[model samples]
Target: MLFDLHEAAANRVSTTQRRNTTTGASAASAMASSLTASRANGLGGLDTAFTSTEDLNCKENLEQDLGDDNSNDLLLSCPHFRNEIGGEYERNVSFSRASAGSPGGSECRLAEPALSTYRTNASISVLEVPKEQQRTQSRPRQYSIEHVDLGARYYQDYFVGKEHASYFGVDEKLGPVAVSIKREKLEDHKDHGPQYQYRIIFRTHELITLRGSILEDATPTAMKHGTGRGLPLKDALEYVIPELNIHCLRLALNTPKVTEQLLKLDEQGLSRKHKVGILYCRAGQSSEEEMYNNEEAGPAFEEFLSLLGEKVCLRGFTKYAAQLDVKTDSTGTHSLYTTYQDYEIMFHVSTLLPYTPNNRQQLLRKRHIGNDIVTIIFQEPGALPFTPKNIRSHFQHVFIIVRAHNPCTDNVCYRQLLSGQTLPCPHCVPEHVPSHCSSHWRNDLLMWLLPH
Candidate 1:
């Protein structure tokens, strides 16, 4: 099937990476392409560009992090990561869902085994902002062209030949999955061009090699991945994801109850599955009329805070356990659900509840239905105090669910992405995202949340 441009972009670079292009010249940086204007944050100071050797060192640093011993290791590893035909390597291409649905999906496959190491030669040039604009801004202005050189040194280290899918504990099967990078805007640029224009183009082999290794780890083969009792999904859940209090979670199951619980309600109060309640207290054990009515007697602030403790039932309705709901999209006709609670405390729940409309739709719009399920973890808005006791408690709850729910025996689900950190998946062959997902984005969440 064809991949979405935005999804394809995210698949390429990994959310953990900071994509910055540095050129050899100290010339001023330029604005991102017109397409990137909407997403551009601001110019990455290109006036202070990296020298060529320094650039190489940056690439080396990334390689070392991926476990490569040296540059020699990168080249030898390239061929094994990418497919070869007639003694030459085949360049992988990106495709949309419609285009990918065809036979060429085989072309998108990574070279058998994938590379263990990667290298790249990315360069960034400075984009100059006009003086008139600069005066108005009163700050140093520069744009950048981050080359991001990526290639592998050893191709043979990963596999012998022929694409084979190892059953990682919790990964989707390695079929015709495409990979691409997305450049999201980190700041606004007002100098040379539109403040937020960027483009996501194809990445070199270096990025692809490293990305493949990361992806491999995320797949099921990296988990409880051996020929054995073939434990069902419930058992695998523990190994795949163990925490859930901050983010709304998603889990796919065969039961109707499980399916119905993941939806969104509109004008109708909560969907049939939802429950609500208002904080109230029993006054005196002696009489019913004497009971403390939160609406009339209890503290307002306390009752308001109680919203976090209890589910909000439909107006005047009976209390319902906040379950997941499923609904269709107004535009794409895709199905999704509303989140059960605010972001701060989603992980506290044992079961996966929908956090956003997109996540819920992913479950309902799945293209393939293997006997596997998916779990998504997210953090709520406020700071969730982390305590040793609470951490252990949360883990225990996750472990229990995994032990009871998953169905796969030999195969277990693996991680596509984890909560706090962002990184590239290793299975994908690096390529560029088209017109859809190129803009500047800063990976560090701290940078995003801190007071500017």
Candidate 2:
């Protein structure tokens, strides 16, 4: 429900600008009209891989109107459009053709196909048009690597090349966070007998990389681990990225589908279940609120954060964390806590409250949000032994839960602290406690954004 069109437009993604392969509406329309008629026949051995409503309709329509005769001419024109080492896709391709020539002597033409020409199902019939017959239709299609729908295979190839996406006429900024794909290793599946494992690295951070194996078939190990629907490496990259991008688009448009999908991913074991300190600032938060559930829907939380400005801030939880009112009485831990490097330690959530002497007119405690807690089990499996030094290493990640002996009755006392005046407690402590402040935080959309 959160993924409706309206919300998607609202969360518009305006990344760094780059050249895009703009499509003409007329060409797309013509292509779609041609394909839909063939849908009945093309249904055999065809995989309807394009899931979105708009793409399916356009592609299907184009497939129908494709004339068997012109189909060969289309392929002969854009030999480079082939899906295989040979001219497979080009042979069956359908798109508007335009004239093109080689650098010095000969001629080369390619089709600048529109999404309307985007077809599905790999095996398509190709009728060879004679060289002389193809001469009249000599207008070659313009060649360009398409950005949005290059398919996962080409995308990986492009990534490995480090060529700007202009090689595909796509916005370079919109490309994957990872810059290149290293060599891939294939291991024989226990049952299926072959699968590829790849190591991918990001452009900005070489040290940071993702390594995962793509399974050819569900083995006993795979079924137990739950990749039943796991796609191949290229396909996984191809599939998950586009889906996430769509989720992003929908988010900008104002849909909460991204949130829903993230939760679902965790539930399906596609993503890790740990909160990683990134959480949604939920609805109905007040001084009395506690027990934060990251998966729960909180529409108002977005509104609150949006109003605060799109900027983010990240700060260590240590000093401010000491201000919360956390519980140690319970042996139970919140399921949200998962071991993250350096942040893993047996620790109780630290909360804070301002203590005021009877004589101090200023309040000692201020409730910025609520006194929520983040408790760590400290004894999870394979965890390092807890030490004060080791625990200190994770202090930066601890979420602060500030409570108070007495809530500030008015802004008069709070304003004094914000104004740079030391409103000291009657006990001689400073009234204004420094809360967390940072230029960027966990909620930043580019890196990774969670609700809070």
Candidate 3:
């Protein structure tokens, strides 16, 4: 069987060689005939005739090879032939077979003449795209504002109104305080999902005379004060100026004209006050002694008091202390007086006031806070909700509800407790208002409340 197979293969090889010789001779004759026809016509006709003859030769050769199934296998097996014409031969065969199978065989053959010529010179004939086309194709995408739903609510309706008043610290004395809280979608905070941007506008009437005086006195004092509080003199000035401005603005807002306008602005809300009053109320503690002596409530209450008007290292050091007439009590029994940002804040503690006989409501403590425009209600964790309706005070327009956070669980709560007890500032620092809405509120007040 091996001897017979060898003999058949040798015969096939001889037949293929003979056919190749004949095909070469026929191709030469066809080329000569085409050249003769082109000369009789024109130069253009010469190109057309040459292309047509070459295509015809390639097609005939491809068809002949295809008819003999063993031709490709034999050529590929021979290393010399495969290296010389394997790629070109395969491409031409594929083109020929595709044209023959397709319905538009004649059109394809005419359209795609001189395939080898095109393939060889493709690198030199690269088509360039026009600059205009490139500009149109690579243009930046237009983002439409109309398609974006911001879903922003009105300032009063969203913040100061009854809806989210619990989460915010609204001071009626500051006039119209607008908190423009914007949220942007963020991928980093997948759990939280959005980053909040707070832009707070304190629309208090400008006190040019008071501001000028405060700046003149405080500027020199602040420069001399140095960076004792870990803040630069410039930063300290920035902090002091805004606070003093707020203080003066609060006083200016109390003028008959501004007070009437404020009343008209929010009639249904609590009446305006000159000073921000804070009242500490604890559940199940009626007497001053009982409230201060309690384990859980006492510590939290003292912490809150210390936060408001904690004693500074340099007593009466700032010019604001003299300007605001802030007299630190030696006894520390009176309403704790502390100057924050040059503004004097007097915290009216419920326990410190005289407990009236058979009066659990404590009208004495109420007298001080009820008259104030903006009142902060500091309640223990399990304390009853101290509503504005219960106070029955017309002057207290805004109620800021503050609850003691669990020091073991809440990070801010723990930090605040530590800072209050250990870290005493040279200047009276403003108490940080804790918000349940967003964590951004913790430090944002210092940044956003800067005077423009």
Candidate 4:
């Protein structure tokens, strides 16, 4: 969206200038000369001038109407247009003509034959007819590319599903981040039949690449590094990493329908009974606000948690992550603690504050959304050992919650730290606390930084 149309225009003009300088005459002149010569003779000879005014007018009109056709012809003729094999022009022509059917077969024959007869028999001066057609033909075919739309494919499938968005803690000054997917290994599967690997590329920190392999694991194994991470036997890998999770998050957000669907799912409610918890900054927040269920909209999310206590499964609980109160830029607020449970599996949702009352209610529709507690059971059949590291790794499967204030607060904070700054959110900084400068800080100091 930031691309400049003017710059694109300038680039096209400059490219044209370069081509003209290298090839001697501009494309317009070459086309004009070819057309003029074709008209004067029988389109096969050097010059024998057509004298009839009607013939001249028809020739000029044909040239004007075939403006892009003339450019195409000229480009085909140019030696520079030839590919390494020297057959590109012919191939292109073949491709073009294959798609271009005759207007109406025999009934819609071109007027070339009648014009030819008029030229051969009449004696009216060529200059007597209008010069408008010739002048117009001599001008550029500036709007030609619109005839065959390119890059329209990228915008086509965008209307289908929910869009999932993930924020990579990035600096605003680094420009917009671009994402792309790369697939590696085309070979057939060896022991397990066949397998493929995909790497998602993001333009963060100049270039940060994450690769993930889909083997027998329900969750794919991820490698958070460059493509240099070599592939090995699927069994040899211990656990799948979280890199692929981020890739999935970003890609989902890119699709509008996907995002809508994910949000809709939260509103519709999941099949499983919901358990809830609420974690919010209490700095600027007043105690008058008690976590409650909306009577009009069924029981409150917190009530569901107490109702489903042991009936569900609290497989494990994690200390609520604590951080300085970001909204007030103060250290008075308590950090939120989160508990992990398994009604079915472990599901994590880290989100920004929901804005409107409706939006907040929609978020509260799910137990995990209300109480930051995840309760999705691992779907794999076999029971296995679970550790802190495994839980952390699986936590990468996160769904986004909209931030009420800043959508990119976390990303902004991450970039500031990467750039050697450890300040709190700028908007929330209070007047009383001493300004925490970026420099002259101990590396070991645990500075409370905020993510938007």
- Specify the highest-lDDT model's number: 3
Error of 4 at 434 (Å): 87
Model 3 clash tally?
2
Top candidate by TM-score: 3
The C-alpha TM-scores of every prediction are 0.15, 0.19, 0.28, 0.15
lDDT per residue for candidate 3 within 1-452, as digits (tens), equals: 00122233344455554553322112323333444554565655555545565555544443222111112211111100111111111122122334422132221122223334222211111123323433332211221011111111123322332221111122333322321221122233556433322112122221101111122223334343221232332333334334322322212322445434433443322211124455655764323233323323367767656645553322344432211223443212344445433234444445554456666465555565556545555566666533232344435444344566662234424111101111111111223323332323332222111111
Cα error of candidate 4 at position 379, Å: 74
* Residue 320 lDDT (model 2): 21
Note the Cα lDDT for every prediction shown.
0.22, 0.24, 0.33, 0.25
- When superposed on Cα atoms, how far off is each prediction in RMSD? 28.8, 29.9, 42.8, 33.0
Clashes of 4: 38
> Which run of 10 residues does model 4 get worst, by summed lDDT?
413-422
| Model 4 regions lying over 4 Å from their true place | 1-151, 158-194, 197-452
TM-score between model 3 and native = 0.28
TM-score of 1: 0.15
Whole-structure CA lDDT of model 3: 0.33
The ten-residue window of minimal lDDT in model 2 covers 412-421
- What is the C-alpha lDDT profile of model 2 across 70-113, one tens digit per residue? 11200111110110111112222333333222112212222223
Position 365, candidate 4: lDDT: 26
